[model samples]
Target: GSWHPETGGLHEAFGDITAILTMISQMDQCEAIICHSKGDLHAKTYFSAVAEEFGYALYGRTQGLRNADNDLTMSQVTEEVHDISQVFTGAFYDILADIFEDYCCPEKYDAAETLFRIGKHITSLLLQALLKGPSSNATFSDIAKLMISLEPKKKWKDMIRRQFSVRGVVGKGAKKVKAPVDLVWGGCHCS
Candidate 1:
């Protein structure tokens, strides 16, 4: 549950502190809680003070996480963020490792890791394109062509009917296809 301040400055902070304090008083009865913020000292201090009140022991993990029994501080969260970054960085550095492996006889793991990153990037790009809308110039014909081009050949007849609403085909004084065909075939013998 989130509570917003009706009117006041740091008084809201006091209110938040009070609410958290009340919640932490019963921390033993609860399993865990997740708190999100912009990593400010005010919030960190509030949680630290509340944890201390609850007699929850805070421990620092080698992974850079600071845990207070069932709760985690932003410092601990930062550690997890760092771990993810390391993974991304390793994926990047693997490109150089691949070159060294083929040209300078390095480990095969490097090439495999680099290939994984390349594959991931390709899939992510395609996923993003699908999630986002079509391009500015995408028309009914373009989309129809794309659907037909895909494997298994999806029949989009209904989609075409709904999309293509042909109107204004018979302009002013336009008789019909039969009349035009007759005129073309008879030639200009009378005229």
Candidate 2:
């Protein structure tokens, strides 16, 4: 559901708006429709129609929910923005690597691939966090620390361990830590 204003033409935006409306039309039991970016006239119109048709409460500025536009409730926006930043950082790294390889060693794409993978993984983690809304009782930072620890790089493992230590937590849980390697392995250890 990533929309780039530069890449998405007017027709594509219209199609997305139409598709959203079509999905809303099929919902049997919709309580509250929370539409972000209701500042867009097209989205506002589509959401208004959805609210009316489904008799669902609309909670967006388009319908007059001004107080809900505060920065606290829209944490997903910040997370998504971070995801986009990570994506761009990876893309920039790839582009630079491509240019370097064209003039230097042609087999250095692996480095770029690794960079891209890290960026993609970070973005995916943030997306999962967004899907599992923060109020559902899991912080994205904690999930990120866990995922980073699972990487093949020792740096990520040490980073997570250091973060856990700084937070004054004994182990992955609140109990005493038995072994650092055990917590870092997360059931994948052998031999």
Candidate 3:
């Protein structure tokens, strides 16, 4: 489906997200290094046990993130799914961050344990959102809207919307999809 822009990107994104969720499901939940170190703090994020490479576009020399934090608006995007996919991926990351921050270590909410639980919960939410949220030819905003509707508790609603908003994915004043669109040749188109 990479052959087409209207639908291919979402399918590719669905596969990528599903794969990440599946991997996390199989992984043994470890106490975040922060929790294990007593008080040695680290940047709050999904700490991959191995070198992770989901967002190839997100990687950089110093910090590796292809706007998965959802800082890039749709108006700023091109036609490439990998680049565009970061908007959703960033939302997912921020959701994880929100959960991590909200459930900070308490007597009841241990930091390490909360990290484990967040993985499980987010995996389910991501699956549900992928299956039930986005439409076939969905724009980023459409997926965002569908996801917002399916949230039973409005969990991270404001954050998700705000992320999508500035990126031009959705909100009161989203503009049109413009181009010189970016494209990935992926062998088929290379010849």
What are the TM-scores, per candidate, against the unseen true structure?
Answer: 0.16, 0.23, 0.65
**Candidate 3 residue lDDT tens string, 76-191:** 65677766666566555556667666656778866666666666877766567667754445555566776666656665666666655666667776656443235566665553
Best by lDDT: 3
Clashes of 2: 0
Ranking by TM-score: 3, 2, 1
Model 1 lDDT, residue 42, Cα: 26
Native-vs-model 2 lDDT?
0.31
What shift in Å separates residue 20 of candidate 1 from its native position after superposition?
50
How many clashing pairs per prediction, in order? 1, 0, 5
Lowest-sum lDDT 10-residue window in model 1: 1-10
RMSD, one per candidate, in order:
28.0, 18.9, 5.6
Those runs of model 1 whose alpha carbons end farther than 4 Å from true positions after fitting are 1-109, 135-191
* Candidate 2 lDDT tens digits, 69-146: 111211122233322222222222222223223333326533333333343543443345335433322332334344
Residue range 63-175, candidate 1, lDDT tens digits: 12321112221122222333222221222122222222233222544323333333343233223433342443222222222322331312322222222112111223221
- Stretch of 10 with least lDDT, candidate 3: 42-51
